[model samples]
Target: QVKYLNNIVEQDHRRVRQRTRSMLGFKTFMSAAKTIAGIEMMAMIKKGQLNIPGSTPFEQFYALAG
Candidate 1:
């Protein structure tokens, strides 16, 4: 049962795992944090998880950044 539950949790993070795997790793904690934050933001936008108004994902990301 615990293994099943863990699989569910791992599936949720699959996208993040795939993204980070290609980066080859980070050199600093701050850079890793920033890069992960951006990755999460893009993932959220792609998943329609945020309600920010914008015609495109880039605009929505800009609105959030600005």
Candidate 2:
């Protein structure tokens, strides 16, 4: 669990910076960190570790949450 958590945290931060480079530069580091974590969840779905149902691109993972 620590590995997953740490990976998410690091990747999230990286993605947030990538976003900033494109547009919407964050004014605060803390705020960007939180937002990054949220977006990271979606990005990590590419790993397909949860085995979500259906054949959707990423929406199937959302289905498994229910």
- Model 1's lDDT to the true fold? 0.83
Position 19, candidate 2: lDDT: 65
lDDT of candidate 1 over 1-66, digit per residue (tens): 575898877876788889999887999999999887887888888989986764699988878767
The digit string of per-residue lDDT tens for model 2 on 1-66 reads: 475898867765686567667766778998877666656665557656445566664575456443
Q: After superposition, how far is residue 2 of candidate 1 from its true place, in Å?
A: 10
Clash list (residue pairs), candidate 1: none
Where does candidate 2 have its weakest 10-residue lDDT segment?
A: 57-66
> How good is model 2 by TM-score?
0.40
- How much lDDT does candidate 2 score? 0.63
Look at candidate 2 and tell me the lDDT of residue 55.
67
Candidates in order: C-alpha RMSD to true structure = 2.5, 5.8
Q: Candidate 1, which segments miss by more than 4 Å at Cα?
A: 1-5
**Per-structure clash totals for the candidates:** 0, 0
* lDDT to native, each model: 0.83, 0.63
